[model samples]
Target chain A: MNDPIKDFVEQHREDFDHLEAPQFNLAGFKASLAQEPMVKKHRILNIKPASWMAAAAVLLVCTIGLWFFNSTQQTKKTEQHLALNKQNKHPKIAEKPLVKAVTQNAKQTQFAAHETTSHVKKHQSKEEVPFIPSPDQMLYTKLNDSASSSTRLAAVLAIKKSELISYDMLDRLAATIQHDGNSNVRLAALSVLEKYRQDAHVTNLLVNALNHQNDPMLQLSLVNLLGKMQNVKIDERLYALVNDPSTLEAVKDEVYQILLKENKF
Target chain B: MKLQLILLFALFTTGLSASAQKQYKLAKNNGKLNLNISGVTVEGYDGNEIIFSLPKNEDEEVDERAKGLKAFNSSGFKDNSGLGFDVTVRGDDINVNPVSVANQPKLSIKLPRNVRVSFANNSNMYQDTVTLKNLKTEIDVAVTGNDIVLTNNVGPMNIKTLHGSVDASFPADLKGPISIISVNGHVDIALPASVKANLEVISNYGKIYAADDLKIAINPASNPKTNATGQPVKTLTIGKGVQALTIKSLAANSENQDENAPVFGYEGGNYAESLNGKINGGGVDFILKSNHNNIYIREKK
Candidate 1:
């Protein structure tokens, strides 16, 4: 039953094969592929615009911080130089370690290269040493000339912080204690006086202040200072304060305490 | 010698019982009054002239015959200064330095308001009360006998008492520094709600208290380590203003004091364990110091 159909199909197969078997356009396909450009694949690790902006901002902040730090250092150096100049002006003081340290920290070699040579040249016509004035000297000057209590207080604080104070400065502090209207300033002056307690001149000034000061706080402070001295001639003042009816009760009590400690009661 | 003693006794008796009354007007532009009295109650009010009454006893006197008082105006150079004018009452100038009147007739003085006044009482003037009401100027007071109460006064104040208490109420904001120091006495300060200043308070042997609404920074020093005496020091800033208020409790020994060496450090210390703090972020330096006394700073209700 399949012989005639099979023979006919086998005869048509060759005829179909002979007909154009769906010709493929290989050249056109290649040309189309060539027309579309290839796109590169995106990578995972890429720098973004925000990253650049952030980097720039950080750089700006660091640069500003460096500038501020340098400026502060420079200011400190200038202050040190001024102090050195003041110390140098006083021929009595031969050594100023603070001046040495500051100058060294500022790279004195560079400073000399940039400044001392030129300074010598410019000031050679005159006898000027071209010294920098110190902040403490300025403060001391203010303390002497300024009548304001707040100014006096600030100056005293600055002087207290100064590395070296002259005997003149000590005398000024004693004067402030005796004359300043503000008790706070007087109290600070007392502290400054405590530093020079061993000095006989300071002791004399304190005694003078005791006689003139009506402020009980000052009186008490003076009494305490006098009491701390050993083998000193403060008994007369103590006895006077104890006997004086005008003496504040607190002061009398303190004086009594001192007397009792000294076994003079 | 016996005859001289009898004469002295007679003079003393006359001094004790002298009774009189007087009045005086203030000089032009002379608004400042200073009172230095013993056993006298000085009251201030709004008036044009000052009146004085010296009662025979400390108690209130109803009988006019039991009192002696006088008032007068005098002008002269004081301690080589330019001509300074003051009203004098009962041999005590309210304008000059205080003079002691022992065994004398008790005095009552009334002063006009808005006058710059300074009152100072000695230890003999026990329980003397100086009350200044409704004033507009600086008030400086120092009392050794008892208590002083300043109500409704404004401007700068410098007050100190040896063995007495200080009770001050400021109705308005103070324009300048206010310093108060007391030894063996309590201090109570009442500030208006609108008060703004930097405050420093220290108490060597007492407790410090502040109102709840009042912002205070206790021991607000940038450095917490105290000086020698280890007494607590405090700062108070009230309302972020330029003025300061400082209170301190002094101790017999506060702040480390080197006996034989120069001090080269930040050398501030309190005498007592002070109640230190800040109020309103700090301003002008107002300082209060006390020894063996409690300090109370509060906002007036």
Candidate 2:
């Protein structure tokens, strides 16, 4: 248990215990769309700007190139953080203890961490199950890369980890979701929000998008969240939707049922 | 000569005077009561005191009873005179009619203020309404072959009969838990909004419904512990801050809440063993079993 890998796993377990994930919106985004006006558009591929298929094809092609692009970039931030804290040497600030422990002794520590995790998953699964970065992270890393920019590479790696605690990672993820993401990636973001849906600070933002969004697919994702809640009192936004004549009949009915089941109606 | 005959008749009358019927009374605390009965009709009375009378029978197995012999005249009758209630044998079954208050049985003992009661009738038919009231300090009951009516506002109570239907009424502010089970019969129970308890109900071949403004919370996956220990050992504790209530029909995964939320320390026993179909709810720990019956579970807040 004294081992750093085990210690980190324990800490991870505690962090996610009794956690309620904050929900996020599921829709297309536009980064800096409201920021700058002047821009020079590049004409590389012959396709309409609104043709999502063409953009997806381009992303599929870019995937191969970005894989190698992001890995080399990840160590740079760790190196930067390491250099800044070199004198203090805050071991706790390491981005991924499992990863760091593995790198220190890759094969041995990974085996030990896995052994402890298989047994400790009762509570620890709350954190580990959700944060186990998806293949999308790897794909995101592969597609979005410039061999020279280490910051962009760091973002790519952080996407793979899905444990991005810094604004740097959030901004990059937000930027990627906004500008160049494929439809599948956009949908994946919505699905991933279940792990973070209960975070109070971000839940309202997610709820606002769900309430206002016209996309059928995004609405479906929002509807699914009704099943997960138990302890928290029903949100008032949903209360209005149940009776609001302006809302769609089906959505209104769904909201009403949730309210009725909770006896808030 | 006439004077001599009169004097002999007077002497015989005084010498052979029959004994008056005897009555013996007994009182019991909260526990089981096994009564032996013969030609006894437990008449349902509305008042607090249970009254008894020896029936006048024209024909019966005991010739003494057939000749209108009072129960107190019998040798075994306990004379509980002027007490709360009395148990007496009656020759005619007409006194145990349904129109009157012939529902709840009059038992000897008094229960706690808030307690759960269950009735299991093996033979004969009886019917009456059992009420659980606001001042539910004691539960008095009777049973026969058929139906049992729970007209009293009892505590977290259970009423199960092997062959009769259970029809009971609960108080608007029912502060205690309740469970009524009956075999080969239908059960009908209603609760008000103010009643809060985890309702694990079962109506083996019958329908169940709670359509009023009642609030029953159901959380099956809320705390599903899948192996792995070292945490607070997630237990499906119910009945905390709730008036105790539990009912089951088969050996299903269940939890019985205690009636009183008293302090408890782990005695050195197999904790996991006790966790078998165990859930903590209400304020009491109930040991429930379901054997061949349709089961239902719900929570009303």
Candidate 3:
């Protein structure tokens, strides 16, 4: 209440209060405001955070679509490649045209079976000797060279499937079982010979394998083979191994078990 | 101490130049000998003690002669428990320690029949062969880049090799398990005709040949499991035959996953061809495995 401004205001109160009021023209002021450069109406649609989000969503959808399309194409390509590889690996067996030809030939042969029966028999006798194609024969020849073990195995399997394996082939399999550096190739040879167990030559090879093979795994197999023959001579040999003090206990136990089962005790 | 150090240093620097032939008669009484000789073949001969033959490098110009046994003792060979030769009253455990020596010389070791031998020979660029006859205990042998020829050994044999073939003959009296593994080579084992044991043989990128005369109980109709290469699994019994083996092949039903399907962005490829069977009604388990090679089991008549 005692402020200096208050005293000054009291002194000039009448002069300040007696000031005249001027009439204002509302319409003219509005006209002048309008004449002044108004904020030029924003002509361009301003980009917003929402607009950016929508653009990103569109880009994401396109990327996903492209990736899905590429993956599907890649899968198709891989499948085709694998099918081609299978065909290449087994050209003789996998050639679809050859299979179809075989079927067609069989169908055609049914019409004149009696007319060609004797001729067919004569051809069949000769066919049995070298029934496989020349390429397979070449493959069998490669089996003897110091080729890769895998290559040798492939050849053996192919030969087994191509024909009634000749005695010569069985001999080769026996030699492989005895001395092949690759056990897998040897095993494959053994499997191929499995169908020829009744052959005297194969039985002799089995007996030879039993006598000379040194690998325990191979020996086990030979023993198993010899046992199936149920030969009295083989049983006696097995019993002798069981009794031999110099023999391995694990091996002796095996022999003991076999002898017990065969009632050879 | 300084003088001793100097003498040792001088001895090490001039080590290869010394062409000395030495023999160690360790444990005149029945004891063990642990020995490791690289770039040399150790032909094990039966004896009552350890005899080491260190041949003299007579060639004067060849300064890279192998030094005689690094640490020797009349009682036994000195070794760290883990890697070196451990010769104790109990037995011998010999391990391969990569010791670089100039022109490494061969060492012939003769030991008593009572000794248990653990021999590992890993020589680079040399094909060393090991022949052990008349062994009485378990044998653990590993040879790399070389071949193993074992004969008339009685014990549990665990043999492994890389880039080499394994040929082992087990006596009929041999007991315990025999596990043989080879990479890039063949495994040939000869067993007595009456041997009975559980068998698991696997060969990747190769074939399995079992003797044709052996009756393997394989039913392809019942066995649905084909190998990675689609070879049907042949499961059968040799001796008394054990419980039926469950052979796994390719999938037989809808739930069975495609083996060739891409897994984790990689192609699912199975290359192993395996045979699971038993011999003599299937007793103890014996495993023979080879990668990129063949496997053969022969009967020891």
Best by DockQ: 1
TM-score of chain B in each prediction: 0.59, 0.41, 0.59
User: How many clashes show up per model?
Assistant: 54, 72, 53
Per-residue CA lDDT of model 1 for B66-132, tens digit only, reads 3353222232312211111233433323454322233333446566655566666655544456666
User: On residues A1-265, what C-alpha lDDT tens digit does candidate 1 reach at each position?
Assistant: 6799889889889776776767899999998787665322233335687988999999999999999998799667554332211222244434664554565554645554556666677657644334454565577776765333445655775676454555556777888887776665676678666655555566777777777777777888677666766556778778888898888777898889889987999
State the lDDT of candidate 2 residue by residue for B1-301, as single tens digits: 8999998988777554422222232232222222322112232223333223332223424545434333232344432332112333233101121111222233322333322222323234333333323325323222333455544363434344334455555554443324344434555554444544444442222334433234333323222221111122223332221212212221122253332222111111111011112223332211111112222232232
Give candidate 1's error at residue A62 in angstroms: 58
True-vs-predicted CA distance for residue A261, candidate 1, Å: 6.5
Candidate 1: stretches off by over 4 Å: A1-170, A179-216, A224-249, A256-265, B1-23, B27-31, B39-115, B123-127, B219-271
Interface RMSD in Å per candidate, to 1 decimal?
10.6, 26.7, 13.6
lDDT of 3 by residue, A20-108 (tens): 88889899999989966553433233557798899999999999999999868755543332211111334453465344445434544
TM-score of each: 0.48, 0.27, 0.36
Rank by TM-score, highest first: 1, 3, 2
State the fnat of model 2: 0.00
Query: After superposition on all CA atoms, what RMSD does each candidate show versus the true structure?
Result: 31.2, 34.3, 28.0
Kindly report the docking quality category of candidate 3.
Answer: incorrect
Error of 2 at B166 (Å): 1.7
Of the candidates shown, which would achieve the greatest lDDT relative to the real structure? 1
In model 1, what is the error at residue A39, expressed in angstroms?
Answer: 99
Interface RMSD of 1: 10.6
* Candidate 3, position B176, lDDT: 50
